[model samples]
Target chain A: MTKKLMKGSEAIGEAAVQAGCHLFFGYPITPQNEIPEYMSMRLPQVGGTFVQAESEVAASNMLYGAAGSGERVMTSSSSPGISLMAEAISYLAGAELPVVIVNIMRGGPGLGGILPSQSDYFQATKGTAHGDFRLLVLAPWSVQEAANLVQDAFDLADYYRNPVLILGDGLIGQMMEPVEFADSREPIKVLPPKTWAATGHNGSKPRSVINSLFLDPEELERHNFHLKEKYDRMERDEVRYEAHGLDTDYDVLIVAYGTVARVCLTALEELAEEGVKVAMVRPVSLFPYPSAAVREAAAGAKAVLVVELSMGQMIEDVRLAVGRSKPIHFLNRVGGMLISPDAVIDKIRAIEDGSSEEVRHA
Target chain B: MLETVFSRPDALRDVTTHYCPGCTHGTIHRLIAEVLDELGVRERTVGVAPVGCAVLAYNYFETDFHEASHGRAPAVATGIKRARPDLVVFAYQGDGDLASIGMAEIVHCANRGEKVTVVFVNNAIYGMTGGQMAPTTMPGQVATTCPLGRDVDMAGHPIRVSEMLSTLRTPAFVARASVHTPLLAVNAKEMLRRAFSYQVAGRCFSLVEILSTCPTNWGIPPAEATTWLEKNMLPYYPLGVFKTPERGSREPLPLEG
Candidate 1:
């Protein structure tokens, strides 16, 4: 297939269409509106439905119903938008419904500026809504990777019968790059039969119920345990990361993800000119985070610098991975601001120069 | 030899319900079950239960059911119906669940004219949470939250949902009926039947608002609760058809010619 130029947001939308996800319910939010815009036009052409929901809250609930009916459905929003979807996301998780959510994250504790930030690291991976549940969170650093990961997300969601999130940021959503399209005619990956889908059993099979309410305390706890077991399998089998310069002896290791990871890649190359042997580890799946990869990448490094758009969120995960063995330094740009490669290089120099106690908990 | 006058609808579970003795939820539940059975849509029907007294509705209905968060039944039903247009979908919601918290979901669903049936039970007060005030609670009515009779100035006048929704140009069916009396119960069931039939015909968005009773929460006898609903709730929330979209075309009426 010939590769075509595309924006990250549009690529994701196109990927969903190609992956046979014809149902999309979404609300417009900054840095991610192109996705819904694309779907609104494209889905109808393929005999699909694209509903611009009244709010992210409604959009998420719409996903719950669509997934329950055994159809591939998707939704995309920014940080605050995803936060608004917390209630329905919990329902989807508890109900074991398969749906894909794309978080083109922007800065926030509350309506932080809209440019782009990785502030939602904990929200996406750790927990956003209530109950003991987990979403398979995938982080992609480039337009091509974002598109590919979205297609993979659909398959993974159905395979696990759980929500799968594609965690991106404003930079990726706004940037343009070449990406290969999945041929729409090609068959998608087959998932196990969703016998429990409420697809009008034709009065032949038993009624199909899609519910999350477990009133009996023991019954609820058993459901929780079942979710935990599924998460354990995901943690074991689905960890994805990129280890750069780890094979060689490097003085510093940088932990970053999504857009920040792409910027860190450029910084590492520039540092090579100055004889600053810097390696990097970029987490591909933020949830079930690539901790083992972080451990391996941190080995023998003098210090690990974690770069992010937030003040310090992913850094906490990095600290856990390195844990007292290596000094962990952190740097960020918040409130919708994008960090330049030069700014990252400056941080690397400062950490190397040992002139700044900016190292978190230093 | 004699024949039975009544048998439980095949759509209702053999097990008992958890609603209080005086609650009208059981009566309404039976109505829906009977409709689904009569239409032969029982197996294919999917009901989205609400977050009020009917939270465990999945246990009562033999057909598939989903428990929605407060006021989100409409949104959830939209999702299910869109994904499986062939399946019959309905939402069972109460006053607090629909009028109070899920107002947006319901309004948007009504406006978009989604192909789904909504069984809205307006009992005037929050029953599951021990008789709290609801968006539908009438003026001069009292509840746990309103130790004094509801003050119109402080608490605001009650919202008439069916009337408000009738203003929207998209719905195929919007009606308000009651189950407070035997005659009204039959009328309420007929509205529900029309709502489900509209959905089955693929005519978008149907909702039937039922004037229900909360005897336990209202501090009245179960029989008195029905009389109370007739006397107090009827005048405030008048019963009748609010909106009905044309069956000829399911598309939104062209922005007024």
Candidate 2:
């Protein structure tokens, strides 16, 4: 298939169509409105339904209902919008329904700025809602990867019968890049039968119930443990990452994901030109978070830099991965800001000269 | 052996219920089951259960079920019905679940004219949380939270769900009925049947609000709760059909494109 220039949000919407997703329920939010915009024009052309829900919470419940009826469905929102969806997301996970959600995150703890920021790292990777549940989170570093991972998201969600998240920032959603969708005629992977779908009962098929409530304490415990097992398996088999310039023994290792990783890649070239050795590990999956790969990439490095678009949220995860062997550094550009390569190079020089104290406090 | 003059509806599973004594939730459930069974739509019907007293509605219904979040059952039912138009879908919700937190969901769903049915049970008070105030709680009605009686000035007037729904230009059917007496229960059942019938005919949105008695929460006997529902609740929330479109109706609804 020929590639076409598209905004990241538009590309993600087309990718959902290619993946045979036919239902979309979403509320309009900044930096991600293009997704619902694109879907509204495209889904109806293909005999699918695109409902602009009354609220993000309602949209997520619509996703839950569509997924419960054995259909590939998706919803997209920004940060505060996603906060409203947290309850329904937890319900989807607890019900063991397969659905895909995309977070084109913006800045915030409240109604933060509408510009690009990765401040939602903790919310997406950690305690999302009131339950012992995990969403298989995928991070896309580029527009093309955004399209590819979205297709994978639907397949994986159906395969595991669990919710999947594609976590991007406002930068990814707003940026324009060339993206090629898979040919629509190309056959998709055959998934296991969703025998539990509440589709309807003919005489041949028994009635199905999609429920998350367990009044019995023991039964609820068992259900929770079963979910734990699924997450454990995802952690083992779904972890993915990319290593750049790791072969040559590097003086500093930079760990990042999503848009920050792309910026860090450019910074790596700048640092090398200045007679400094730097490598990077960009995690592709944030939940089953390529921890082992990060540790290996950080091996024998004198120092490490955890760069993000937030106020040092992902730094803790990198700290857990690399441990106390080396001094870990954090570089961030928060509140709808981006870090430049020159600033990154300055941080690398400071850390190398053992002026890490000044940079850390900065 | 006694003659089997009455038998349990095929759509209702034969099991003991968890409802408190004198609670009319069981009666409403039976009405829904009977309607679906009589319509011969049991096989293709899917019910969306609410988060209040009827939270376990999925357990009593024999067909497909989806348990929605608090007040989000209408949205859930919209998703299910739109995806599989061949199936009959209805959302079962209580007063607090539908009229309070779910108010936005139900109103938008009705305005969109989604082809689905809503079986709403309004008992004038929250049942599951030990009877706090609900959106449908009447003026001067007393509950655990509204210990001083519902002040019209402070709490605002109780919402008339059926009347409010009928004001929308989209929904095909909107009715308010009570199950206080056997005759009234039969009347509520006919309204339910009509609502479900609209869904079966692929009509627009339909909702039936059934005024029920919550004896435990009302601080009265089951029989007195029935009379109280008739005397106190019925005057405020009149029991009648607010709107009914021509049968098998369909029209374009604004989806906020």
Candidate 3:
């Protein structure tokens, strides 16, 4: 009913609870610990369960189990912890189970740092374990957006019978923001019944088996195609992005997401004061990546600038989307380094001055 | 009219299993099916099958099933039991799956006193992976990995999982049984029944570690595999109750000969 100022991680947990997600399985990792901590305190009051699993490996499997039984379940962790969950993620994808996973990204090749980084963009969108399957990835730029997307993640997961990942960074996890959950607790969409759940037949129906193993090669190929169809549908129907300054003439189009996108918005305001028109496209869904939107936005701009917390991961997608139609530039801060608005303004100014080469290697 | 007796358990399907000849997995499956039928929980039971020789265990059971990754069956079962406390849940795992890769999941599940049943089959070797050494592999016993007899100096000593778990502070039903012989097979069924009964009553975590035989992996004839288990394996892994709610003390029951 009333807006509550909450930490991003806590808001994500509350949003899940409001969405009727009663079961949470998680292992402690920096930056995202608030999620499980909040769940442990809040779930029991709502007659739900929160299990602090031994490791990320076990926590993800617990999700597989709970989801197999037709319950709305979720888990959250940071970068390395997410890596540990890769195997189970593949299994969940293969099994076509509906579960929500949140990754409050820190830095990494290993246990990098506890500060914000978007290095896991590729991990979330591309190689999330060995699979021909894909997880519907949603990237939220603010705490309120993170809360809203976590709730949407449940519905999207159920709608497609696939795992949906809420990809946030450490900043989004730690930053406090006012989030308004709907007063009337109703799901955003009506979902199909989980008739395939392994909740015991009770002799009235046939037994249900939740499995991903396909020994027959032909059967496995067909299963892969079946999953491909779901992902294809996601790409067609679930593409979401926010385009700013697109209605007016702009020279530079910035492609960014999550926290970096917010940073770019501030840089956009400063650049506009300097008479440099900079339009931006912030992708909301990372997997069904607003490719067409990026292309359409890039068509009107002289050059495209891709910003991220990682070196150059999402830039690959941007390049694919724009495809040499215009000169594309890259800017980033890695290993827990935050990209300041001044740095972004400098890059935009350099691009406008045709001195982009000076900052290209910067 | 002719009297009918000893038909297949209602909880077991009629399809043939992929197990090699003389593998005791079939016996253990039957024992579990019988227990589910006897307790009248067949309709409300969800079984989590591990990734080993019993990877296709879901197909053998008539109840609802979930196939879990290697060593994650306990975690999976914990999810199911916690989500729907009304349903009966169990995880069937093997030596490599439970005692090695899944060691942390099993120990924590037991320590937390999760209300679920675990059927651990310890054949002392990895069957599906082609006779590799396992965490419970007996000392001086040869495996494909340990070609020249397992040198305890090189490989660590075998883990007595039931005994180790019995020392945990939480209340649970932990026991070691065998299905190498008919007498032991009957005892194993009772032990399995007790394990499931504990979960049915929502008592605590329960695990029945059944010492099984892998004739194909052991490089022995099926009949001689039982003799090998009795003569060699039994001494190290004795059959007995390791922990029970009635027995408050942490000490295990006396080792059976």
Interface RMSD of each: 1.5, 0.9, 0.6
Residue-level lDDT of model 2, residues A133-222, one tens digit each, is 999999998999999999999988998889999999988898999988756544334687888999776657777889899989999999
Write candidate 3's Cα lDDT for A1-362 as tens digits: 78999999899999999989999999999989999999999999999999999999999999999999999999999999999999999999999999999999999989899999999999999999987889999999988899889999999999999999999998999999898988875666688888999999677777899999999999999999999999999999999899999999999999999989999999998888888899999999999999999999999999999999998999989888988788999899998999999999999989988888622321
DockQ of candidate 1? Answer: 0.65
Q: Candidate 1 docking: what grade?
A: medium
lDDT (Cα, tens digit) per residue for candidate 1, span B1-257: 89997999988989988888778789999999999999999878888989989888888988887778778999999998888888899999999999999999999998898999999999999988999999999998998999897899999999988878877767468888887777778888888888899999998789988888888889989988878887898888888776677533222232110
| Clashing residue pairs in candidate 3 (N, C-alpha, C atoms within 3 angstroms) | none
Worst 10 residues of 3 chain B by lDDT: B248-257
Better of 1 and 3 by DockQ: 3
Ordered by TM-score, highest first, the candidates read 3, 2, 1
lDDT per residue, candidate 1, A1-362, as tens digits?
98999988899999999888999999999989999999999999999999999999999999998998899999999988999999899989998998999999887778777788888989998878988899999999999999889888988899888999999988889899999975554334567788878776456777777888887899999999999999999999888898888887898899999888888999999988888899999999888888888987888688888888888888888888878888888878888777789998998888889964646464
Worst 10 residues of 1 chain A by lDDT: A182-191
lDDT of 3 at B45: 95
Q: Residue A84 deviation, candidate 3, in Å?
A: 0.3
